[model samples]
Target: MIRMQRLIPTGDPARPVEFTEDAQPVPAPDEALIRVEAFAPNRGETFLLERPEPGLMPGKDVAGLVVQAAADGSGPRVGTRVVGHPPRGGWAEYAAVPTHSLAELPDSLSAVDAAALPLAGITALRLLRTAGSVTGRRMLVTGASGGVGHYVTELAAAAGAEVTVVTATPSRAERLRALGAATAVHAVAGARGPFDVVLESTGGADLPVALSKLAAGGTLIWFGQASRTPATLDFFDLLSGPEGAVIRHFHYAGPNAGPNAGPNAGPTYGRDLATLVRLVHNGRLHPEIGRTADWSKTAETLVDLRERRIRGKAVLTTGVVS
Candidate 1:
């Protein structure tokens, strides 16, 4: 029996995520077995690690080579390099990834870069698609320093939207501008808006303020509450805002639709990932990788990510130089 090194929850507050040896995983009929070379950390998964359930494996984004093809004859063939989202257990040497969640990687793309594109990339892609054509429109994005936030800013800007991002971090603001944000303000109030679209993630007190900045018929897509605070809005205040204004709930994996669905229901996880990868290959999209280290540093890396110390996406190589 072959064993692989994987990360698991220790269940101790002092150190939640730790490394362990586990038996190699077997692929499901519709899942391919990937020998992971690198993986990226998302903020949500790191939070779960702080008090994870026993036997819970935590990982969503990974890039590597296919070691075994799926029994059902789906996805990339063995020996193909790919990037994927395994529901869980991706922080291991091998993962059983569903075919629908995987995409082939080009030779020009490194495992580290590809690993950074799954969850965050897909979320940003879908959000922008939901907002429709941003060409010449005013848009505002909160939490611009985060993985998903930066992607939204860049993609919207590329499509010709005038993007204004809110971030208290002065240093990160400059980086956001280079990614195509027309302006970066220290607070939501600093923004000059009535924006046609708003991709808000920082929530809390900023949620309602963001809503207030929307144009008459604008859409406000609420995706996350990184502030970890509740947003309280008065009924009258909401009613007083722009007419036909909407606040749609969004998630990377979900129904991706509401009362008024867009022409596209939304792109699939695998489909969006492929688009992101192609954009990256063509230099049309850049994955803002803020940190890269060996997989052994996952615990420390995750801690930095949880505390919001790390910017953009964090990638960890599995001791594979090539």
Candidate 2:
């Protein structure tokens, strides 16, 4: 049994998580036994807890060392420096993760930075990769100050895309500009668009309007919904327009998601997260991590995130946020 932390979801993040002294995990043939040094969870984990799903261990990202190798040599050998986003077991001290999702942690990255790479980094990478003609293409990233959207602004700008960002906080405007966004508009900014690709990281009332800003044939990838509020969109409204466009609902929970998490096996876990790690290693993708929490205090911050106070990624750490 492995010592682990589990959220006993009761609609409150401030409450201390249940400490499980012993949790057992079964490793499949293509899995690795990782000695989890530190890990973090995305916003999805919170929502997931509200709507319980059996066998779904909430936390997804991890930075750790390997402890065991399988008979088929399907996983990284023991003692490999690795980081990954597993389908589950991220908040635990030990996790049995698919080898496909693991990537070698670069010599340059600390465990804290490695912990930030998987979910947000790869989402930005894929969004940039599929976003066509980014060179001089007008781009708008909703929730531009958040984890994934912030990186989208950075990578898109580096790709020579003229970036326009939409953020909830006015103070985040300067930060967005620093990340290479050509301009930053507060939530009240009038309908602005003609964006080649809109990274839909925030969902709610402004969602449809943001989608409307996409130029004809423009694409929008919906990766996250920070607003507890739901969206109401008419397909025809988006589908029929002078600038008739396309929309791709993107959730980074897939196989080719990060710079390292590789060809996964389960229905939802395989993605090349390694490519994301490589970018951070090469300096193409930089995530604006606004806050971090230790396993000791993540519950408190998660509540803060749920309350809409998070300006950038709120990373949960085994180490303090200082």
Candidates in order, TM-scores: namely 0.95, 0.85
Q: What's the lDDT for all of these models?
A: 0.87, 0.70
- Residues 1-322, candidate 2: write the lDDT tens digits: 4445454445434552454555656678888877777676666666665555555556778888887875568757888878877877677767788887788876787667778777777677766655656887888777776677777888888889888887767679888888898888876246366777777767887778888788887887777777767989987876665275777776555554433436762433234567667777888767567677677777777766656677767766664221
Taking the tens digit of each residue's C-alpha lDDT, what string does model 1 give over 1-322? 8898988887664566788889999888999999999999899887787778777898899999998999999788999999998888999999989988899999999999999999888888878877888999999999889889888888899999999999878889999999999999999988898899998898799999999999999999999999989898888999999899998988766655322244554333677778889999999889989999998888888888888889899999998644
Clashes of 2: 17
Predicted model with the maximum TM-score: 1
Q: How close is candidate 2 to the true structure, as a TM-score?
A: 0.85
**Which candidate achieves the best lDDT against the true structure?**
1
lDDT of 1: 0.87
Model 1 scores a TM of 0.95
lDDT of 1 at 218: 96
